[model samples]
Target: MSDVKKIATRDSYGAALVELGKEHDNVVVLDADLAAATKTCVFKKTFPERHIDCGIAEQNMIVAAAGLSTMGLVPFASSFAMFAAGRAFEQVRNSVGYPHLNVKIGATHGGISVGEDGASHQCCEDFALMRSIPGMVVLCPADDVEARAAMKAAYEHEGPVYLRFGRLAIPVFHDEENFHFEIGRGEVLRKGSDVALISTGLMTAEALAAADELAQAGIHARVINLCSIKPLDEELVLKAARECGRIVTCEEHSVIGGLGEAVCAAVAEAGVACRVKRVGVNDEFGHSGPAKEVLAQFGLDAAGIVRAAKSLLG
Candidate 1:
């Protein structure tokens, strides 16, 4: 196998914001005193007047971002996933979502991927929080190309959008021209009949690997790159559930109220029957360690995905 070329979605977000700033003068970026770590430092350096540091107050940052958006400025707020959705949820709900403000919450360091920072810094419940909001849009791009597209799309899209990304470098599966994205659409990566591996974010890559592994074992698996967690592609999900006898959902988020839960709800509502399994972070806190080790320990790695697939097969 070739060496896995990985790129962090946070890096892609930083680059995309800089490009957006250069192309559109009204695009502003705000950070909660984590410009360097969150990769908003590049934006701050490029557009000094447009970048605002809220000094560790994520809640205040959300309010300020909503205020900026209300004034017809496209504000992309930067912070860790936990702080953006976990801490500033009320501000996002009332100030941004309620008013339908065009504020982009560029949440980084999602799920167990923000290893060594421990459980507090790692946000496993962000999707659950954001999806519950009435008017908020929940998005989690699978790779660098998708991340760039999502950033650009969020700027063009109206209403409050929550874009979740990770801190660690992950395998980049999509190229610039290969795949395109829509707000509520999912992409079919591979086609098969026996089973379907549906996933989003960092776990998408792992699901792809698991599919390849299953192929070697004479099992044909279809792979679906499901980036938009909320407002999920119910039609596509149900079709997959009907076509494939077994369904497996992969995400770096928690097993509860995340991609897995979203898919399950869709399947249940659609009256689809299939052997469904979920691969992701369990209901447990994280610990400070290397990213790979943390993923393995938390059963969020490729091996975990393969195990899930095997169980579904049985």
Candidate 2:
């Protein structure tokens, strides 16, 4: 795993912005004084005139992005998840989400992956917060390939989009030349019948690894990657529940209202008689520690997914 090519999703977000800027003159980038950390500064290097520094006022920055959208410019307001989705909730909901503006929020450093940034920076509830808004499209990309593709999709889609990225540099598994990403769709990476391992964000890679571990135990777990959280791939989730009869959801977010709840809701509404378990951070705040250690402590890694699947099968 150490030898594998790895790049943080935040870096991918910045690279994608450069590509979008080069292609579309209407594209504009804005940041709440976090151009470097959130990686929006890369776009500023190429299109300095198009980038705006909002100077730490996240709420005001969101409103400005909304205003820019009305002027026919595609604005990507960048910030940390804690500020982008937390501090600017009211403005994002009313200013951007209410009118369904074409404002793409590049929220980086989501979940406990912020590591030593501690509980104050770790936002385990951003998915729930962003998903509550009407007409808001929520997306959490798994890797570099998915993040880049998701950015392009959000730019093309007309509505409020919350693009979640992470600080950790995870594996680049998806082949860029072959991978395809839609606004509201999921793909089954591995086939199985004993159980289904569905996940989003960084956990998608862990789910794939867990499938390998389950195979050794003859459990034959299926792996599902769900980068889109708002307009969930209910059709794919229902199909998994019906076929597998048992499912385990993995995410870097909290189990309360994130990917787990989304899957459970889909199963319940479809009347699927499948048992499900959520592999994610519990209803608790994260502590200051190394990112990998914190993820292991909260059981958000491959071992956690495997443990949840075994529990369901047993």
C-alpha RMSD for every candidate: 1.1, 0.7
Which candidate has the top score in lDDT? 2
Model 1, clash count?
0
Tens digit of per-residue lDDT, candidate 1, span 134-170: 8788999988999999998888888889999889888
Estimated TM-score for each candidate: 0.98, 0.99
Q: Model 2, 1-314: lDDT tens per residue?
A: 78889999999999999999999999999998889999999999999999999998999999999999999999999999999999999999999999889999999999998999899999999999999999999999999999999999999998899999999999998999999999889999999989999999999999999999999998899899999998999999999999999999999999998999999999998899999999888999999999999999999999999999999988
**Clash count list over all predictions:** 0, 0
**Over 4 Å off, model 1:** none
Pick by TM-score: which candidate is best?
Answer: 2
For each candidate, what is the lDDT? 0.89, 0.95
